[model samples]
Target chain A: MIPVDIPLWADLLASLLMITGGALTLIGSLGLLRLPDLFARIHGPTLNNSLGLGSVLLASILIASIQADRLVFQEVLITLFVVATAPVTAMLLMRAGMYRRRADGGKKKAPQPDEST
Target chain B: MTTLLPFAVSFALIAFALAMIFAGIRLLRGPAAEDRVLALDTLYVNSMITALTLGIQFGDRLYFDIALLIALFGFVGSAAMAKFLLRGEVIEP
Candidate 1:
């Protein structure tokens, strides 16, 4: 009963992509909640950063392009930004976490000077 | 397919809401400073996704700009916080 102007194929593809992307994002957040410890939880967001967001952006691109009858690819900018920045953020956070752990007297002892030499 | 799109979009929206809630819970309950920062990072990303989905739902180009802004600032915020955590200052002297 809904009045959709886009072609059925495009609608099907966009819906499929959106649904899949949403599911992946949900799973990523669930991982963030269920995983124990900061180190383990850090792995969770990466899931959404790559696969989940990528698919959703693809769906956005598809829907926009089909509706406008031209390739409206503005969403690609987001994909590019996320791809470029995700690893950097992950690395920075990991390094910071390590720094904090060390500052708090981490599990392993620091190496001592070679006194036997 | 016409009917399917609405259902699919709604599902996506609901999923995003749930995801945001989970991220918020993590942001609030995370024990360490780094954990809170990570949660904040996730929160922004989730918000960006919500904006993108809203764009899709409403067929608006404006939300794309919103999503882009969120992505840009989220990265900057997360990176600054991480740097502060590591060096005790966002900018080194």
Candidate 2:
């Protein structure tokens, strides 16, 4: 039950923002499936985490503020929460992956330098 | 305020749902545990966005609270899974 009095420019702007965020999110997950390795796959979600989520949150904040007819920016709190937590999760998951690899005696270490003459 | 927001939310719902499917596929076909964990995390975030889009469509503030709760739990679950992977135990102090 969205209000109908919002300007065309505002609506159009929100639409553009939504589409951009959604597309970025889709691409990020797509990268998860298509990427080669675990570490490489980590890069994909970061795109969605930072820019994708940020843009969509911005659009939501804009629309809600308009609808409420006041300075309602509480959605910014989610943005802040996400921005702060995403990297920490990424870092933790990476360390865990490295731990798993090392425990399995997998390829978690650097190769030795060869000095064959 | 017009058809634009509705259209965008609908499009977002479809697109993000499709993204979730891809993530689900990765989760099921994880060649490594970390990949599975990552897919699950992505799924949580995608679903959160889906809820937010629905909230926007209906102009309901309650959905905001739901989205916030999802974000909180998703973070905790992801962090716990990561911790479990880091150490072999979850509750071991």
Clashing pairs in 1: none
Write one digit per residue (lDDT tens) for candidate 1, span B15-60.
Answer: 9899989999988987898889998999899899989989988888
Task: Identify the CAPRI category of the predicted complex in candidate 2.
Answer: medium
Cα lDDT, all candidates? 0.86, 0.84
TM-score of each: 0.90, 0.90
Each prediction's fraction of true contacts recovered: 0.73, 0.72
Kindly report the docking quality category of candidate 1: medium
lDDT of 1 by residue, A2-116 (tens): 2378778878888898899889889989888899877778899888898889888988898888778889998889989999998998888887776666533455432232336
> Could you tell me the lDDT of residue A22 within candidate 2?
91
lDDT of 2 by residue, A1-117 (tens): 777888888899989999998999999999998888787899998877888888888888888999988877888888888888888889888877766664333564622324254
